[model samples]
Target: MSTSTSTAAADRTLVTALRERLQLDTGEAVSLVETHISWVLLTSRLAYKLKKPVYLGFVDFSTLAARKHFCEEEVRLNRRLAPSLYIGVVAVCGSAQAPHLGEGDPIEFAVCMRRFSEDALLQRLVPAGRLELDRLEQFAHRLASFHGRAQIAAPESEFATPDQVGRPVVDALARLRVDAGARPTRDLQTWIFEQRKALRTAWFARQRSGAVRECHGDLHLANVVLIDDQLTAFDCIEFDPALRWIDVMSDVAFLTMDLEAHGRRDLAFRFLDAYLQHSGDYAGMQVLRFYEVYRALVRALVGRFRVRAGAAQPGGPDYLACATRLARMPNSAPRLMLTHGLSGSGKSTMAAALLAVAGAIRIRSDVERKRLFGLEPHERSIDHPTNIYSREATERTFARLAECARTALQAGYPVIVDAAFLRRDERLLFRALAAQLHVPFSILRCRAGEADLRRRIVAREAQGRDPSEATLDVLERQLATQEPLDPGECAAVLDVATDAPVDVDALGARWLALSLPPITRRPAGWSAS
Candidate 1:
C-alpha cells in the first residue's frame, strides 16, 4: 500500500475506535493530528491526547511502559492548574476491532482533558479586544499565589542550578544551530548564551532567597484559559522536574513574553506589575528581559526543530514566524511612582488604590519598620525613646523603603512608597534614589482638614487595627514638626483631598501616562519580548 493509503487507514481506524469505544459521538466531525510524541483528537466536549511511540533524546515514550508513565505524569502535573479540567489518564486496550477504555490489558495510554471555548484563550481574547488590564492583574495575582504554594526542592537538589534547569533549552538551541548553519545559529546561540549567563546569577539568588521552586515550566498564553470568568493555566511541563524547578520570575516572564507576542504589551505590563506587588520579590526585574528573550528563543528553536524533523505539518512556518517576531522585539523598563503625605492623611488608601490600578508594588514605611523590628504590623513598641518610631528607626525604615523601591523598579516594575514624608530630608532620599535608578518618580499627597485628621487618628486608636501608633497627642506633635515642601519636593506632588471621593484610578492613569515611555507603534508583524 502507498504511504497515503496507510496513513488514511490508520486515521480511520482511530476515528472509528474513538466513536465506538470511547463513546465519542462526534457525528461527522472528526479530526486527528499526529505530532512527534502524541496523537491529539479534538472532540465535542473534550480533547483526548494520547502519547505516540517515539523516542526524543530528553523524552522517551517509545515503549508502552514509558508512554503510560508520561500519561500519568501529564495528569498529575496538569491537575495543579486545572484540577477540574484535567480529568484523568485512562488505558486503551484490545484490538482496533473492539477497542475498550480501561478494560482488559492496556495497549495505549490517553489523557482526557476538558475542552475550553476557543475564544477563551488569551491568544484569541487579545485580538478580540476583550482582554482587560484588570483581568490580567487578577491572573497575575493568581499565578503568584500558585507559585508561592508550589513545592520548593532543597538547595542540594540536582535541579537547583541554571545549567540543570536550562539544559533542554541549551540542547535544543545547539541542535537548531547545527541544522540551520552559522548565521542564524550564531545569532541565536549568542542570545541564548547571554541569557543563560544571567539566568545563572538569577538561579543562585533565588536559591539563596528561597525563590527557587517548582513552577509552571511552560507558562505561555495558550496554556491559560478563561472559563467561567476564571483563568486556568494548563499543560505544564511534566516530563522533567528540572525544567519546572526554576526561579519564579522565569515562570512569570514566559507569560509576559506570551502576552507581548500576542500584541498586548499593556496587559503584559499589568500582569508583571500585579505579580511583583503580591510576591514582593523586586530582584526579579534584573533578569526578566533576559528570561523573556530566552523563552521566545526556546519556542522559536522548538518550532524550527519540529519543521526539520518532519513532525510538524506544512504551514508550521507561521508558528516559527510568531516565535521569531517575539525574539526580535526590544525590552522596555517599568515606570515608578512615589507617595508622600502625613500620617492619617490617607496615603495608604491612595497607595493601595494606585497599586490596584497601576499594578505597582506598594512599599509602606510602617509595615517595613514593623517587619524590621520582628513585630506584627499593629504591634506597638514603647520600650525606649530610640526603639519606637524614633530617629534611628525612622532612618532605617526610609532606607529600607528606598532599597525595596530600587529593587522593584530595577525589575521593570513601578513602585509606590507609602510614607509620611513630612520632612525635606526624608523626601530627598527617595528622589535621589529614583534619580540614580533613572526611573520616573512622582509623589501623591493626601491632604485633609485638621479636624478630619484628628477624627482619623481617633478612629484609628479606637479601632486598634492600624499599624500606626499615632494618637491625638502624637498627631499634634507631628503637625508642629511637619516641614513645608521644598521646590524640588513641590515639583513631584499630586495633591489629593481626603474629604471627597478621590479619583485614584484617574490619578494613577495620568501618572503612568506622563511617566511611562510612549507605547511605540509595533511594526507590521511585530511580536513582543
Candidate 2:
C-alpha cells in the first residue's frame, strides 16, 4: 500500500483499539468523532483528540513526532483563551491492539479536553433562538480585548504578507472551480482580484501597524460554546502558524460571515459594531468585506469536502450564496448621522438600536474620550477627572469622533456618532465632513423630559455600569449651554422621543431613503455574481 494509505490504516487501528478499551467515569462505550484532520474519542466528561497522520499541504500531522508536537501546541495555544477546557497533552502508548493512554512510552499522543454540552454551542443556540444579544455583546467585548493583547506578528515574519493572505483564497478557489459551476467561480475570482488591488495598501498598512496578530484561527460558531453562560472559544488551528497568525480583522470576519450564513445579518452587524466599539479598529472596516467573502468561500470549500465525505453539512451552495450576497454593495448609500442629545437622553442606546437597521458603525464620545486617556469604557478617570472633561478635552474628543466617522464613511459604511452634539459648531463639523465626502448627512434628535433624564442619570451612576461618567453636575452644565437646532438644521433631523418606544427599523428606513445611493463602481446593468 502507499504511504498515506498505510498511515490511514494504522490511525484507524489505533482509534478502534482506544474506543474499545478506554476507561471512563461513565462506564459507557467510548464514542468517536472524526473530522478530516483528527479523531476524537469521547467519554462522559473528557475528550481525547488524536491527529490523523495526513499531510494537507497547509498543515502536516503525517509523522508521530509531528502529531505529538502539535498536540502539545494545541494545549498550549488553546489555554490562552479557554484554559479550563484544555486539560493537557496525554500520551497514547503501546501497539494499536492494546493501546494505553498516558501510561507508557509514547507511540501516539492526544490532547485531552473537558467536554462541554453540545447544546450550548452557538451553532445550535442561533438556530434555536436561544442566543441572546447580551451574550453576543459580552463575547465581542472579550474577543476584542483578547485581540488587543494578542502577540503581534514579528516584522520579519511572512504572516499577513499580501502573497500569504491571498494564497488561501487562491487555493480555495481552485478547489471550488472543480466542485462548483465554472462561470460563478470565474466571476468570484475576478471580483476577488479587483478587491485585493483595492485593499492592497490597507492590508500592508494594517500589517505594519500591528493589526496582524496571533488570533483564534478557527473562530466559527461551531468552535464556540457557552459554558456557565460564557462564550468560550476553542479548537484553534494549532497545526499551522500561518493560519493562526493573521490580521485580526480576518479572524473577526469568520464569525461575522458565519452569522450571516446562518441568516442572522442583524446579529452579525451588531457583533461587528460591538467589536469595533471595543477595539477602536474602524480602519479595519475597509478590508472587512474582502475578508468576509474570503471566509465564506473557505467555509464553502470545507462544506464541499464534508459532503464528499458523506457527512451532513450546510452544503457548499449555502455559503456560495452568502459570498455572492456579501460581494454586492449595500442596498443604500453610506451616510453620516449625528445623535443630538444631552446627558442621559439615550443617544448611546438609540445609536446602538439603529446600527443593525442602518447598517452603520457607531462611535461614542464617552468611550473614545476615556480611551484617549488610556482607560477602558467603564473605567473611572479619577486621576484626571478635570482634564478628562475639560473644554480642550471635549474638543479633542469631538475631533476624534469626527475622524472615526470619516473613516467608516469612506469605507462605504454608514456612521452614527453617539455624542452630545449640543453645540451647532460640533454638529456642523460633522456635516461639513459628510459634505466633503459627498455622502448624505442627517441628525437624530433624541429627547427626554428633564426629570426623566435626571432620574436615569442618577440610576446609571448608582449602578456604575455605563461608559458615561456624566454626573448631575455634568447634566446641569450640558443643559445650560446646549444649542437647539435651527430651522434649517431641524429640516434634516429625525426626532427620536427617547422616553417613548421608537421604531428603529422604520426610522432607519426613512433616514436611508433620504441618503444618496452609494457609488457602486460596477456598470449599471451588472448583477451580483
Candidate 3:
C-alpha cells in the first residue's frame, strides 16, 4: 500500500477505537492529531490523549509498556488538581480495524479526560476581559490549599533538589545556544547560571523548611479552566517525577508568569496575594522570581526549537511569545515598604494603597497578636499586668512580626509591616535584619492630631472594631512612653493625617524613587489602583 493509504487507514482505525472506548452510540467523529509527545482526539464528551512512542532526551515512552506506564502516570499526577476531569486510563483492545474498548487482547493505552470549554481557560479569558480578579484570587487560594496537602518526596528522590528539577530548563537552554548565535546564547547562559545559584539555595531551604511538595508541574493558564465556578488545573507533566515534585512556589510561578504574559499583571498580583494568605508559606517568595524566569526561558527555548524543527503545531506562536516574555522576568525584585504609626494615623489605609503597585504582603502586628492569644480583634483582656501587655508579650509579638517578614521575603514577596513601632530598639532590629538580607526596606511614619486619635479610639470602641484595644487613657499613656525613631533609622517617612486626603500615590512614588533603581522603576502614572 502507498504511504497515503496507510495514513488514512490508521486514522479510520483510531476513530473507530475512540467510539468503542467512549461508548458513543451516535456517529461522533474523532481526529487523531499528533502533538509533540502525544496524540489527542476530540470527542463529544471527552478528549482522549495517547502518549507517543518516542524517546526524547528528558522524557521516554517509546515502548508499549512504557506508554502504558506513563498513561497511568498522567492519570495519577493530573488527578491532584482535576480529580473529576481525569477519568482514568483505558486500554485499546482487539484488532485495529474492529477494536473493542475492553474486549480481546490489549494493544495500546490512553488517558481519558472530560472535555472542558476552551474559552474557560484563564489565558483566553484574560484577553477577552472575561477573567474576574476575585475568581482569580479564589483560584490562587484553591491551588495553594492543594499544595498544602500534597506529598513531599524524600531528599533522595529525583524531585528533591534544584539541579534535578532544573535539568529540563538547562537542557533547553543548551539546545537554544546552537541556534541563538553567540551573544544571545552568552547572555542566556549568564542568566541561567545566576538563576541556578539563587534557586538552588531556595530549593534547599524549602526542603529544610518543609515547603517542598508534589505539585502541578505545568501550571500555566491554559492548563487551568473555570468550570462551574471552580478552577481546575489539568495536563500536568506525567513523564517525569522530578518535574512534578517541587517547591510549591515554583509551581505557582508558572501561573504567575503566564498571567503576566497575557498582560494581566494586576490579576497576577492579586493571585499571588491570595495564595500567600491562604498557605501562609511566605518563605516560598524568595525563589518565586527565579522560578518564573526559569520557566519563561524554558518556554522561549522550546519556541526557538519548534521554529527550527519546523513544527507548525498548535500554540507554537504562543510558545515563542512566552519565551520572549520569560527573557525579561529578572528585571528586579519586588519592593517592600513598612509603615508605623499611632492610632488614627491611617497606616492600614496606606499599606492597602501600596498593594496596587507592588504585591505587598501586609502583616498587621495587632491582628496577629490577637490571633495568637485566641481573642477577637476588638476583644479586651482583663489587665493582668503581666499577661496582656507585659515586656515578654511585646517581645513575642515583635518576634512573630519578624518571623512573618522573613517568611514573606524568602518567598520572593515584598511585605509591609503595619505597627506602632513605639520602641526605637524594635524598629532598629527590623532595619538591621533588612540590611543583613540585602532586601530594600523603608518606613512610613503616620501621625495625626491628639484629638483625632482620641475620637478615633472612641469610635472604634463603640463599633467594637479594632484590634489595638486602646482606650483614651491608654492612648495618653502610650504617647508618653512612645520613643521617636532616630533620623538614621528609617529609609523614608510619610505623614498620614485623617484630615488630609492621604497622598498615598505620592508616598508610593517616593518609596519607588528611594528603593528601586531607574531600570526597575515603573513608568509614570503607574496605578496602584
Candidate 2 lDDT by residue in tens digits, 116-189 = 88999999999889999999999999999999999999887889888888777877787787874423455677
Question: What TM-score does model 3 achieve against the real structure?
Answer: 0.75
Off by over 4 Å in 2: 1-4, 23-26, 180-187, 314-317, 516-529
Report lDDT per candidate. 0.71, 0.85, 0.70
Q: Of the candidates shown, which would achieve the greatest lDDT relative to the real structure?
A: 2
Error of 3 at 236 (Å): 1.2
lDDT order, best first, reads 2, 1, 3
Model 2: residue 493 alpha-carbon error in angstroms? 0.3
Off by over 4 Å in 1: 1-16, 23-34, 165-199, 302-337, 342-399, 409-420, 423-425, 435-482, 491-529
lDDT of 3 by residue, 1-529 (tens): 9966775567457656665654554466655556678777777687878776667877997678999998998898888788899899988777666665565567778788888778898778888898877788778878977987888777666565777656766766665666643124455566667777766876777787767788888898778998878878888988777778788888999988877766666577668766765666666766776677667766666556666677644543354344444554433354555677776666766675666455567677776666566654446766433475778887887788788887776555567887878777777667655665567767877778888878888987888745667688877777888887766544346555655776665666666556533333332233222
Candidate 2: residue pairs that collide: 333-518
Clashes of 3: 9
Give the lowest summed-lDDT range of ten residues in model 3. Answer: 520-529
lDDT of 2: 0.85
In candidate 1, what are the lDDT values of residues 1-529, reduced to their tens digit? 9966775466458546865544544455645666666777766787788876656676777577987898898898888878998999987778666666667888677898887787898767877888766677778877888887988878777665777656766665665567643224455556666667756876777787777788889988778889768788888887777778887888998887777666666567667766755665667766676667667667667666666677654532233333444444333235556666666788887776676566566777777787677665556766533475778888888878878887767656667888888887777777666666666667787899888888898888899866678788877887899888766557667889987898876887777765522432222232221
